[model samples]
Target chain A: MLEAAGTPQEIEGRSLWRDARIRLFRNKAAVGSMIILGIITLMAIFAPMLSPFEYDQIDWGYIQEGPNWENGHIFGTDGNGRDLFIRILYGARVSLAVGLLATSVSLVIGVTYGAVAGYFGGKIDTIMMRFVDVLYSLPFMFFVIMLMVVFGRNIFLIFIALGAVEWLTMARIVRGQTLSIRRREFIEAAHATGVSNFKIIFRHVIPNVLGPVIVYMTLTIPQVILTESFLSFLGLGVQEPLTSWGVLISEGAKVIEASTWMLIYPATFLALTLFCFNFIGDGLRDALDPKDR
Target chain B: MNAIGKKKAVPILSVRDLKVHFTLSGTGLFGKERKLKAVDGINFDLFPGETLGIVGESGCGKSTLGRAILQLIPPTDGQVIWLGRDIVGAPHSAMQPLRRDLQIIFQDPLASLNPRMTIGEIIAEPLVTHKADLGKEEIKARVKRMMARVGLLPQMINRYPHEFSGGQCQRIGIARAMILEPKLIICDEPVSALDVSIQAQIVNLLQELQREFDLSLIFISHDLSIVRHICHRILVLYLGNVMELADRDSIYAAPKHPYTKALISAVPIPDPEIERNKERIVLTGDLPSPTNPPSGCVFRTRCPFAKDVCATDIPTVDTINDHHQVACHFHERM
Candidate 1:
């Protein structure tokens, strides 16, 4: 689209990555979602510092009370008399951190493993992919619980556990991408130029597969967040004082009739965050479309 | 044999009995593994500075032969002798140095270039791979020079392949191949993906560069018109086997093999009167599956003059003269 020969306006030619970046910024919904997501992430980070009361501290004076500006418990108190607003912020921290960190873990493990298998192909491909298929067949939650039990329930354990599961899909996605990409002319051209096999896999094969990898990454974040929430809902995730969106929502559910405001706030934040991520993912898919160019 | 005394220059590359067969094993149990002999027993000798055009229809293993020669697709059997050294099964590391001498220019100009890379990076990749000691500044300067030679503006070095026109993209592909100053370049239908108007320009550029580099070229294409213009000699392939090899003038003026005759007949003459008046040898029947090709001569099934001998015995390549060869059981009579 950036024809350099005749156009006077053209100074520097736009690389596909740069063009994609420009397109992403131009998409209003994606831009707005990024802004909103940034705000929520910031809010989650500063929740402890911003909130006047501790997340777990009970205000006996306003026990099970509705939101009131007088006490600064705007989102009101839970059945335990803890401040709802600060608890939601703390939950945001756990939820967002799980989404981002777990995806990063999967991205690292999945891309490298998948690129190696796909680029080498033949017997190596069969062996590696079958190994992935075996991992895929294992019961998802059982694997997570086993990891959690063995690792002593640390939050970092959750990151690895979710990542371990999500990476199977990631590996598959990247493998399928590179299977086609390896046969692409550019890759063959790379080989013809005598680029080492490892170099080709890491350089040519991996970067070309990034478009799909990134799209899957955005999808995986929300999926990980939801799974973490489900684990928390079952009371198996993030122990006592530490709270997540899932934990808050699950707690809010038990006291729904008595404290409706408690459920409303965290659920709104969780839904809004998921919505924003989906929009951003859609924007990315469109932006990175080679066909569109 | 009519003989004459002459000084013979040693061939730079000789491919003897080079075969590339792929066995496609079935997915399920008791699946039969079928042998697809893509380029079976191809033989040719390329002299320095000579352009050998390989012309064949689709699925004739023209591209396969080129790749097999380069060792990109390892040949299942036979010898690819490069300067008297057999390199058919050479290890990747051992072949790294050989790759510098045997570069390839691929069809589909845009696809051959890595889209993520800029024009500068794409052209510089071969230099970076082969010449590890060359400094980045020197590489960049060499790349800029090559771009100028290939007719691409050096200022557009940072632009991606998608940003360039098809013809321009092809120049970039050529620049990549020419950068290393390889002795031989196997151009696998390099201009097939370009515009008809642009094909001649690319072809002319290749010829100009060939003279500059003293390069032996294996120019493969389905287009005979373009091939005749640039190639010193032409080899016609039919179903993974050579049908004829002759000098450009002889092959065009007097084709001995039926398949070559048919192929040349299909080429439209530039003059309208000659084009309309010329006989077009339109052959019937689809190309037989390579898995189970017709026995003896592969072209016999559709050969207009096929005899019982053509079916029972394979026709070996026979020399008509020092520079011409043909494979037909009845060539002497025909």
Candidate 2:
């Protein structure tokens, strides 16, 4: 009644989504992480124009040099005389691209699959969810490495591989959400109004469940990035000139005694990026939780 | 829309022996299913432009019957014949057009509306669904008009349901139901969730709208006074069985069955003197569980005048008067 009796202009209503956005922006940690993520993404995009040298540009003289700003090699040179700073920037592109693309793939597949399962309960839900449970029981990383071995280290395939494995959790999350949402009276009201199941699923059901899906998405992106790095460490990720943070870190690990900058720089950036994503995800979970409202 | 006003004698909805039984999840290993007969073999007819109130206690299955008649919940057995078409077991796809005509207003107003949609969108949803060719302007105009009719401000159409009070949200729910111009709108305890003061407002609004739209309503409620005020005919149910079905005056004045007598007696008289003098028939035992209802008669376990015959012999509904019916073997003596 407090809101109902308010003046018209004062009750200028905000939707659940807009309200969640306002709350998310209020959190300092989430906002700070977002800014760092933005900067890193921008650096990844403008790596070629900003860097003094190409990712693989070899200079035999300055090999294994410490980070010195004098020769325009801000992060010094790698063991193979390539500019480390530009390689790290290039690594950001590969890592972030893999993260986003893999997550996108999972989002599309998982949302559709879960919506179908949850909307049509009983036998269909049991079968669909049992399929997910079976997939969950499989050794995930082992399968990803197997796919890479079978497909010959294709970077695009890595996106598909990681996405394929990652969607099990997403499906489970979306399905659980959909199961609860499908029973809501609004859904019944929609059903009673002769709205087709398809419309009900995509328009009414999905929009409501998006809060959890979105929070889960933020969490999944960082996980996907870390998984890509692990694959690269195992020599199964982006090969050769196509460098990721994982590849850089593994290479750095080999000659850490000689030049610690390679290991230190990539690892620091990777850790910071993951930490920021986690913080933002936590903030989103808190903000979007219906219980909090 | 086709049969809105064509016939006067024929009932808009004829539900014959309708039953809705929910099977509980199986126990331990063998998983023997147990059936809870929520609405067990109930029959009723709803004519156009008349309000039929179903009054019962908490576990009387009144809500289940409403949903079963609307086909919102699938019935375990029997016919829900709407305009000669038996829609008891019709598939969801086939029920699409029929859904437009047979709409429902839920008990919880806010929960029954999509939290994400604006009030305007929620009201316009039925129109958009049933009349797909309606122009955006036309839909908006109709929504604004409906909102105005429901005593809600048309200017606040953009506000969400959360911003609205309980009564306002019920107004929104009513608007949604009335927008489609349905032949029948089942009010499933629409005012039960509102404040007592607000309940009268909603009830009066519904009465006004019913006249304005020539709408048939199956108003389900447990409040006897509210039912007596608005309902033309009241059906008294006890544990899924109709004890009495009569016009408001007849049911209130000379209730035949023991259960109806108890229910009507419980309604408090406004005058203190009459209220003090009134005889209240307070039943002793708790309502028998639906899963294990007493043999022959559902209300026998709680009926004060329960004899040996009441337990073994099922009482058939006997027509007591022109418009009064009672399903009690010992009604004449009572």
Q: Which ten-residue region of model 2 chain B has the weakest summed lDDT? A: B1-10
Report the poorest 10 consecutive residues by lDDT, candidate 1 chain B: B1-10
**Positional deviation of A110 in candidate 1, in angstroms?**
0.8
RMSD (Cα, Å) of candidate 1? 3.0
Q: How much is the lDDT of residue A85 in candidate 2?
A: 92
Compared with the true structure, model 1 gives a TM-score of 0.96
The complex in candidate 2 yields a DockQ of 0.48
Q: What RMSD does each model have against the real structure?
A: 3.0, 3.1
lDDT of 2 by residue, A18-43 (tens): 88888889989999999999999999
Task: Tally clashing residue pairs in candidate 2.
Answer: 0
lDDT tens digits by residue: candidate 1, A211-282: 989988998898999999999998878987889999999998988987888788989999998989998998
Give the per-residue lDDT digits (tens) of candidate 1, residues B1-334. Answer: 0111111677889999989999988768998889999998989888888889999899999999998998889899999999889998998878988888888888998889888888888999999998989999999989988988988778788888989999999999999999999999999999998889899899989989988988889999999999988988899999999999988888999999999989999988889999999998888898899999999999988889998988889999999998889999878775
Candidate 2: Cα lDDT at A17: 78
